[model samples]
Target: MSEIGITCTGAAVVNAIFNATGRRVRDLPITLHKLL
Candidate 1:
């Protein structure tokens, strides 16, 4: 269902952010401060 897509998409975004910045964000509503 849509849930699966949402989960996968979020995971991909998180992974990308981690790869680019070497940070792991384990929360929702990722904000700029969370990366710093």
Candidate 2:
């Protein structure tokens, strides 16, 4: 994917996690520690 598309996908993943768990993650690569 293009750069913008990749960024959007990453943002979407972060948003999904926030919506599901009510946690705001501000890091890239979405580590397991961030999930917990």
Candidate 3:
């Protein structure tokens, strides 16, 4: 889903992804995060 884009629902977006998968975004890679 992130590959497409984040939804307008903020945390709900992460929650949806987490529900579908099994991982939580504890942290992002520094370089990738800094770019965003």
Candidate 4:
């Protein structure tokens, strides 16, 4: 049960990281694309 809890917490952290990285990446290209 403790291991499962740790695994779930790790998964949540990874998901949050992915979401933040994705948001930053998605925002970056629009201005460059517009300029180009």
Candidate 5:
């Protein structure tokens, strides 16, 4: 159960990015171009 909160971490990050840039990133390893 070491990874139980892993999804929450990822979701939080994605949500923060979306809130800041108004973009929804569906892929892993968020990059510069993805936000641009």
Candidate 6:
């Protein structure tokens, strides 16, 4: 059997935001202000 690690919701959101806005965030806790 194979085991997988936990997924990071913050990373996913940051990636999505980066892809859409071309902004790379290197901070923790992705907030609405960061995205804007």
Name the better of 1 and 3 by lDDT: 1
- Scored by CA lDDT, what does every candidate get? 0.91, 0.88, 0.52, 0.50, 0.90, 0.75
Top-TM-score candidate index: 1
| Model 6 residue pairs with clashes | none
| Model 4, span 1-36: residue lDDT tens | 798897677556555655765533223223434333
Clashes of each: 0, 0, 0, 0, 0, 0
How are the candidates ranked when ordered by TM-score, highest leading? 1, 5, 2, 6, 4, 3
Clashing residue pairs, backbone N/CA/C < 3 A, model 5: none
The residue-level lDDT of candidate 5 at 20 comes to 92
RMSD of 2: 1.7
Error of 4 at 7 (Å): 1.3
Residue-level lDDT of model 1, residues 1-36, one tens digit each, is 988898799889999999999999999779999999
- Encode model 3's per-residue lDDT on 1-36: one tens digit a residue: 774455445566556656866656544332434333
Q: Judged by lDDT, which candidate is best?
A: 1
Q: Which residue pairs show collisions in model 2?
A: none
The regions of model 4 sitting more than 4 angstroms off are 23-36
If both were scored by lDDT, which would come out higher, candidate 1 or candidate 4? 1
| Candidate 1 stretches greater than 4 Å from native | 1-3
lDDT, residue 1, model 2? 44
Colliding residue pairs in candidate 4: none
- Candidate 5 yields a Cα-based lDDT of 0.90
Clashing pairs in 3: none
Q: How does model 1 score by TM-score?
A: 0.79
